[model samples]
Target: MIAGLFETHLKVADLKRSEHFYGEVLGLELAHRDETRPITFYWLGGRGEAMLGLWEEAPENIQRQHFAFRSTVPEVLRAPAWLRERGLTPRNFLNDGTDQPMVFAWTPAIAIYFTDPDGHSLEFIAMLGGGPRPELGVISLEEWQSKL
Candidate 1:
């Protein structure tokens, strides 16, 4: 069985600025940091369950990237409110896109999309049970297995 994700490294043009935004505003705990090397990694967790990760090393003025996190339906709905208090805009998946949110198509699950400080698409979605299954991204069982 697969375990949870470790960390995601992002290259930020301004490390200090990204650090402040993620550490101060988002309130993620700094697991390891090296200012002289200018690399910092934040881990979001209480004991051993780390669900959030961040890095600052992207090139200057690059388009935002997307990263998704897992949560329960309630957490998916409530987290945005907390994030909004810190000035982070939460775009309901059901209300976004030229057509509609793909999240809704995956029934028994719910998700709320939002952007990070750098405009990167971040989604907190509830996967009914836990974690994501390959079928969640496929139209048919054959389509899912064929890729592998």
Candidate 2:
């Protein structure tokens, strides 16, 4: 059986721009890089457990993918405003182009969705336990947290 997630790799369009997003904006550490060779990689989380890698590669068709970085409940709640503070706007899967406050995925995780520099869907999620599995895939964070 699989133990747990080790790492995830994403093909980014621009190394410098994507590095800034993941490094500065997201605050993941720059674990590895090379000055001689044309390669850029980053590691998130601890050496054991889970991690993420950013690769310097151009997309072929660029089928966008969604990934989430685990965050605290308060952080998930504050994410939209925090992103907005840096002039980065958050969005929802509904695609109405409005900054979604948060989403209660019925798995009972509170998530705040947004896109990276490469248009990859991303989220900060907090697994808040105990909630009815609603058929409505996305519920407002306020409504979910209010129930807590």
How many clashing pairs does model 2 include? 0
Model 1 gets an lDDT of 0.61
Error of 2 at 53 (Å): 1.8
Which candidate number maximizes TM-score? Answer: 2
Q: Which ten contiguous residues of candidate 1 have the minimum total lDDT?
A: 97-106
Clashing pairs in 1: 10-57, 11-57, 11-58, 12-56, 12-57, 12-58
Model 1 C-alpha lDDT per residue in residues 1-148, reported as the tens digit of each score: 7686766666566777777887898677777787667678777555356634445555664567787776666676577677778887776654443211234433435566776666777777665543445455523223333433
